[model samples]
Target: MSLRTSFAAHRRTRARLREERAFERLLARAPTVESAHELRALATRR
Candidate 1:
């Protein structure tokens, strides 16, 4: 595969993992407005 394709695949995988981890963390935390906002911000930064 070309370098571009490899990079794209890597990015997609990393993003998926990050999303899953973030969801798990969010769930572990209480369902508060502050936690929700923090999750949103963390996702946006990624």
Candidate 2:
């Protein structure tokens, strides 16, 4: 509820969004078959 905690949470959210966007871009740049394989591997690993 404090201003400092709220600001920190906002920053964390922004960082997560940026990371997700970058990961999407990474996957977008990969070749189709390779991307599919990589995504599957990541899914199982998760």
Worst 10 residues of 2 by lDDT: 35-44
Which residues of candidate 2, in runs, are more than 4 Å off? Answer: 43-46
TM-score of each: 0.61, 0.74
TM-score of 1: 0.61
- Residue-by-residue lDDT tens digits, candidate 1, 1-46: 9999999999999999997897878757857878878877776798
Q: Provide the lowest-lDDT 10-residue window in model 1.
A: 22-31
Query: 1-46, model 2: which lDDT tens digit per residue?
Result: 9999999999999998997788777777778977767875795676
Clashing pairs in 1: none
Global CA lDDT computed for model 2: 0.82
